[model samples]
Target: MKAFAQVFACLFCIALAGVSVAQDAASSTLTDAEQAFVDQMTESVLVGQFSVDGRSDRAPKPERYSIQSVTKTSDDNWIVQARITYGKYDLPVPVPVQVIWAGDTPVLQVTDLKIPLMGEGFTARVMFYKDRYAGSWYHGKVGGHMWGSIERQSPDEGSKTPESESSESDE
Candidate 1:
């Protein structure tokens, strides 16, 4: 009886260990290098003095762009789920785009997009995918809604805090 119990306990522990490792890998935070890529692309999109720069103004300006969730769907890709509110109405729009690293720059390309660019009572679904290249990885100017795209990143990302945190305090 003691032997059997010991075996069962060992197996149970091993299973739990496996599960924990998987969760970590699945929800793995973006590496330092990856975050840098996201930052650069975002900077590129910021238009200064209506300069017609990358595409910030033309990108529909989703009200809130803080990434809500991220899941690793593959080795080279991540499924980035974000809730975007557009315009004064601040309507709830969920957009999931794919992000990957190309060379030193992290490329935020669109795997799929959905938007209604038509008349009232109109609905649109965009399965648009952007194939961009730049330096080492992506070319550039890949997928997006309205106009442009950048790999979204939360501010105060690199700190000694937990992963499931906003890194912001009530101000």
Candidate 2:
């Protein structure tokens, strides 16, 4: 009976140690810079314009990305939960992107990512610096350049539609 008790206690201690290791890993996974980026992007809006490669005559269309959250899943992987409002479509998508750094700047890369209603073979390389982001995006044969400013949103403000966001951008 005493031997059995000792074995059970050892197993319990090992389980507790495993939980502690997991907690430590979870807490320390993201570096300070990465955590700051996550904080900056959560509940924020990217308001900007996108230009098609051959559509110079057409005015750049208004674009808005309402970020619900940005979470780092691994060293180079992040999931950006954002509501994309552009053209006539509004979609809330959890975008899995690869993050690579250039010095202190973090660039988000999406290669041939397909979202429902958006079609397939979508690729983009976007980088953030301070309060702005710029990138090139490709979908099928249509590709373009996109640039925009990031605006922090209050929790109660809620996400805006393209028309409403466009009006604000016009001002």
The model with the greatest TM-score is 2
Cα lDDT of model 1 by residue, 1-171, tens digit: 222222211111111111223325754465766444333333121111111224454523211123334344455544433322222222222333345545454444432233332111111121212322221111123222222232434454322122123233212
For candidate 2, the TM-score is 0.75
Error of 2 at 77 (Å): 0.9
Off by over 4 Å in 2: 1-27, 84-91, 156-159, 167-171
Candidate 1 error regions (>4 Å): 1-25, 28-64, 87-94, 115-171
**Which candidate tops lDDT?**
2
Report the CA-based lDDT of candidate 1 relative to the real structure: 0.29
lDDT (tens digit, per residue) of candidate 2 on 1-171: 222222211111111111223223544677777766776777777767777788888877656566766766667876766655444655456667677889888888878776565455767788889999888776667777778888886674345555675487679
Clashing pairs in 2: none
